[model samples]
Target: MTHVLILGANGQIARYAIDLLLNETDAQLTLYLRNANRLSNLQSDRVSIREGDVLDLATLKEAMESQDVVYANLSGDMEGQAKNIVKNMEKTGLKRLIFINAFGIYDEIPGEFGKWNQRVIGQYLPPYRKAADIIEDSDLDYTIVRPPWLTNEDEIDYEITQKAGPFIGTVVSRKSVASLVVKMVESPGLHVRRNLGINKPNTNGDRPAFME
Candidate 1:
């Protein structure tokens, strides 16, 4: 059975990943969040709950132990969190990582969507970019996922760009993102050391639908 540790368990995308792992694979999960009580419905034999911050190295180190895969779905001060995860993983010799950062981190988005995203998230991308830098520099088997504006749809229709062209499409469903994460965990070497941009197939627009 695959053993996975999910950081930022409280986030919506992470929750989706947790459910997919528990329901779809013979996977044992250690769910980490700042508040364990928030995970009221996820208790099960295959799941263990841990409450702590990823920035807390001691706690993060402990969580990384015996974990075959590490999936981080976090936001805010992500550079610090990435540093913490990378440092501890190096110490523990844990290699596989699936990290979720947003689409604009690489300045890859094009057209009005790119402009809108930049105007909207100008303040958040610096640290996220730094986070990507840290992970890319590390020797870990890492896939840096840059998903477009997230939607709540359940459909898995998505497209992938491997850092080769302009990031197409405007929004991607969280379910689609979870599917990719699950795929990577179940098959460890699927996209090792690659940066992937995930988006909906035909949803490309001037901006996210919500704003237009």
Candidate 2:
């Protein structure tokens, strides 16, 4: 069975991914978080929860051992945390990763949509880009997922863009993002070495439809 470590298990996207993996695949999972007690309700034989921070080398190193894949859904000083993950994974001989980054990390969004996003989240873009750079520079086989504004929806449909493409679509469902992550974990070859942008299909606007 594929062994997976989810580094930010308490995140909404990570939570959805945990449920999907448990229900749809035979993979075993270890959910690592600062406060894993928040996920006590999901405790099961196939799922193990550990309380830890990604920045703690010893704790993270122990968590990475023996895992086939590392899926990181994280925020805050992203570049630094990503640095820690890269170092630990290198130490553990783990190479596969699924990193959740935000849209505009490449400043690829265009037109009014681009301007809107900048106005909304200009402050967060730099650190996110720095984190993406760290992952890109590493030897690890990684899929960097750059998702647009996320929503809570049941729909699983999304369109994808490679890094250089003008990032399209406004808001994609968090479930769609998680679904893709689980698909990658199951297949293990879905989007290796690619930086992907995900968005709900048929969506286009200055801002997410939900905002209006």
Candidate 3:
């Protein structure tokens, strides 16, 4: 069985991914978060919860043990968190990582929606971009997932754009992103060293529908 370590396990996207991973795959999971109690209900033979902050290098390294993949669904102090994850993973000799980030980090979103995105969340981009840069500079096999504005819709309708191209669409469902994450977990070789932009097809506009 594959052993996957999930950082920021309590994140909304991580929650969706966890449910799908449990239902669709036989991967053993180590759910690492600041509060273990948040995921206590998920404890089972294949699921283990670890309570510790990502900035805690010693604890983070310990959690990386015997794992095949590391999926990070995190926010706040992203640069610091990314550095710690890279450092810990290097020390522990774990190579595969799946990291979540925002779409406009590369200014890849085009047209009015792109400008609108910057106006709305421009302040948060520096740290997220720094985090992405950290992962990109690392030797660990990594996939940087750039998801557009997210929604809670109960569907998995989405598409992918490579980093070199303009990003498409305005929003994608959380379930869509989760499905993509699970697909990456199931096939470790998939999208290695790639920065993916995920969005719902044909939803392009000046802003996300919800925002409009």
**Which predicted model would earn the best lDDT?**
3
Q: Write the per-residue lDDT of candidate 1 for residues 22-71, one digit (tens) a residue.
A: 88999999999999999977669998999999989999999999999999
Candidate 2 lDDT over residue span 102-184, tens digit each: 99878799889899889889877999999999999999999999999999898898988999778989989999999999999
Error of 2 at 1 (Å): 0.3
Which structure is stronger by lDDT: 2 or 3? 3
- TM-score: the better of candidates 1 and 3: 3
Candidate 2 — what's its lDDT? 0.92
What is the lDDT of every predicted structure here? 0.91, 0.92, 0.95
Give TM per candidate: 0.97, 0.98, 0.99
Segments of candidate 2 deviating more than 4 angstroms: none
List, residue by residue over 1-212, the lDDT tens digit for candidate 3: 89999999999999999999999999999999999989877767999999999999999999999999999999999999999999999999999999999889989989999899999998889999999999999999999999988999999999999999999999999999999999999999999999999999999899999877
